[model samples]
Target: MKDSILRLKSRLIRTLKLENLLFKFLPNGIYVFNLHRIGDRHSCQFDRNIFSCGVDQFEQFLLLLKASFDVVDVATLSQILDEQQPINKRLAVITFDDGYKDCIDKAAPLLVKYQLPAAFFITTDFVGSERIPWWDEMAFLLRQSTGRVFKSLSTGQDINLQPNTIEKQIAQVIFTSKRDNNHTLVQILDDMREQFPQARAQLAQQSNSLFMNWQDIHQLKDMGMDIGSHAKTHNILARMSTEQQLHELTLSKQVLEQQLNQPIKYLAYPVGRYHCFDQHTLDNAKVAGYSLAFNNEKGKNRFISERYSINRYCFDEGDLSTLKLNCIVW
Candidate 1:
């Protein structure tokens, strides 16, 4: 009970901060992307359709941005940064988080059709695998396990959860994970795994089931997509000790840099919340030699520490107008 309340409080605070920051300024470019956008919710098709822009709503968005400013890629972004001059209006950047195969399948064609350049921030472990993300791992276990769902670390309350409610319940756990003091979320996920043996095995298999392979990354590169680091394991940095955080940041950069045979100067914070990182993490990134880094927090860029903690907004529900608004607002 105590922990649940605390988790709720922290989430409220984080949301308010994000809202406050996002509404305060104008963004140089609109940036948004995520792994899965298809609505079927059941079929995880590799390459079937690329309808993000073809839909009437997204089409109107594409037209609006096209009419507004020069839709540019990472190269142009880098150039603008180098030149230190503000580019014109409607400047937007399209980016997809995690190396989902569908980004290449579904999102890429739409981008190519529109002749827009974008970036793919990839988590190294999934670069060549089909792993369900860690967050999904927890959710899957909760969904597949029979009987009781979660226990409140503070109150020892065991909440009975239906399979359909698993996603929402797991999301609450993620919120719980935000509190520095709560390991209940982790404990619940861990115990749930042991509670269902067959389900655990299935989830373990599926956990390795949904990512872009190394060849896919190359293909994206060939498509003029900018590749960036998303940490090796995708653990929340603030949760790890200093050394662990350093290792995560450095090794991921090295792996991507070697695989791509180019500098990996950009980074996106794993699980990307402000509390998810610290000054030490930024310091470690510099020591690891990154020139710029991005966080998932939505906000406009201003003079900050070495551009390593650059802020970014997420595009959800395929809402192009909100996408454009956040782009301009950020």
Candidate 2:
């Protein structure tokens, strides 16, 4: 009953705000939507890593946006931010990460309905292949294991794991796994594969969590969405050697640019954290000639590496209120 009341209040509040009934004074605005799909709640495959913005909710969000503000691409928003143009109303930009196939199947038509432009960042490794994301392998291993106590290969020490709850397992894996331990990540996954050969085989045959294929990417490019690089294999950059980092960043950009037959222009760091990028990585990005870069931080951009460190909001429930609030604040 309490939850029902809270939802009702949330709906009421959103209805009032949709009509411009609250916070009418704030000026410059930039809203970024993290386009994605919500997969199985308990699936070991990127259960939360890759997003899951369902089609129906996405349509509703677009409907609300159509009724409210002018939609623009990152390029236009950058020009406004660069020129310091005085804008009379809120401005919004729609963006998707991980380059899900749904963006083409589910999202593209809606963009046409409202004539909105968006940006999609693609992780080149997963394109044209069936390789599950590394993180998903880890999640699957942890979930499939029976024991509550497990020791990571690198640490060689036992840590309590709560296999019963997905949230707790996710939190444990993230907190306990060191970002630099690539070898350990691989070994742990191998261990899981040996123990669950059938599961591994099933994963082998399963298509990558529904990514936008080359054809879909081409169609989206023709439809006016900005396509950018999201690293080769979505590895954490800062932990890698400078050369390794350069290869990850530059190769993805080169491949995408060649395919699209246009300047790729933008780069989104894999894992997109402050710690994930260093001076060497930034230098490589600049050398690669990217016009802009985006981090997954959710807020307004204000002068900190705005050229290479733009902020973007991740999608949760694809609720209109959250979308509107994110734009108003950004």
In order, candidate lDDTs are: 0.64, 0.69
Output the worst ten-in-a-row residue range by lDDT, candidate 2. Answer: 38-47
Name the lDDT value of residue 169 in candidate 2. Answer: 62
Expressed as tens digits, the lDDT of each residue in 203-300 for candidate 2 is 66765655777888999999988898998988778878999988998899999989989988788887676777877888888888887787776665
lDDT (0-100) at residue 84 of candidate 2?
A: 76
Clashes of each: 11, 6
TM-scores of all candidate predictions against the true structure: 0.77, 0.79
Question: Model 1, poorest ten-residue lDDT window?
Answer: 44-53
- Candidate 2 pairs with clashing backbones: 36-53, 37-51, 37-52, 37-53, 38-52, 101-212
lDDT of 1 by residue, 202-290 (tens): 75564355678888888888888888888888778887888998898899989998988988877778767788899889988888887
Error (Å) of candidate 1 at residue 73 is: 1.9
Over 4 Å off in model 1, which ranges? 1-39, 42-64, 152-156, 178-180, 184-188, 204-208, 302-306, 324-330
